[model samples]
Target: MALQNEKNNRYLLRDWKPENPTFWENKGKHIARRNLWISVSCLLLAFCVWMLFSAVTVNLNKIGFNFTTDQLFL
Candidate 1:
C-alpha cells in the first residue's frame, strides 16, 4: 500500500526534494549537515595519519636507519 511504501522510503531519501522548503526544513537539511560532518571528520583523520607517517620518516635517519635521500622521499 502507499502508506507502507512511504514508511519504507522515509529513510531512503529517494524522494528527496530539497527545493521544497517543508522537506528541506524537515529532513534534507539534517541529512546534508550530518553527511558534511562525517566527511570533514574523515578528512581530518586522514591528515593526522599522514602527519604521523611524515614525522616517523623524518626521524628514521637520526635513529641510524641510513635511508638515502631518494628512499626517504619515497
Candidate 2:
C-alpha cells in the first residue's frame, strides 16, 4: 500500500539506507561528531548551574534568613 507523504514534504517511513559511501564518510560523520559535542557541553553547563544553586543555598545562614542548619537540610 502506497502512503501519502507528510505535510513537510519529507518521507514518513523508516526505510533508511545509508548506502552512499562518500556521503557516509564525509557529511554523516561530521554531523554526528558535532551533535555529540553539543550534547556534552549542554550536560556540563546544566551541572554548573546546579552547583551554583547549592553554593547559594549553603550561605543562606550568612544572610540572616533564620533558617537553622537542620532546616536547610530539609
Candidate 3:
C-alpha cells in the first residue's frame, strides 16, 4: 500500500508563517487581536464549564465532607 498510504496521508504544517507583509503589519494586527480575544474567551468559557462540581463540593463540605485536597481535585 503505497497508494493507500498516500491517500490516507495528511499534510501537516510544522512551519506556519503567514504571508502578505502589509496584511500582517496593518490589517493582520487587528485580525490577530480579534482572534486572540476570541481564543481567550473560549478558554475562559471552558474553565467556567464543569465548575458546578466546585460549588456542589463546597455545599457538601458545609453539610459534612470537608474541603479536602481530594474534594478540591474532584
- Model 3 lDDT on a 0 to 1 scale: 0.69
The prediction achieving the highest TM-score against the true structure is 1
Q: What would the per-residue lDDT of candidate 2 be over residues 23-66, giving only the tens digit for each residue?
A: 75866566667779999999999999999988988998898787
For model 2, the superposed segments whose C-alpha errors exceed 4 Å read: 1-24
lDDT (10s digit) by residue, model 1, range 8-49: 785665767889999999988999998899999999999999
TM-score of each: 0.76, 0.58, 0.44
Candidate 2: which pairs clash?
A: none
Candidate 3 lDDT, tens digit per residue, 1-74? 98787777654323334597865676667666777999999988877775766677668867877678775675
Residue 33 lDDT in model 2? 74
Please estimate how well model 2 matches the true structure, expressed as its whole-model Cα lDDT.
Answer: 0.73
Model 3 residue pairs with clashes: none
Off by over 4 Å in 3: 1-17, 57-74
Which stretches of model 1 miss by more than 4 angstroms? 1-11
**Worst window of 10 by summed lDDT in candidate 1:** 7-16
Query: Best candidate, lDDT-wise?
Result: 1
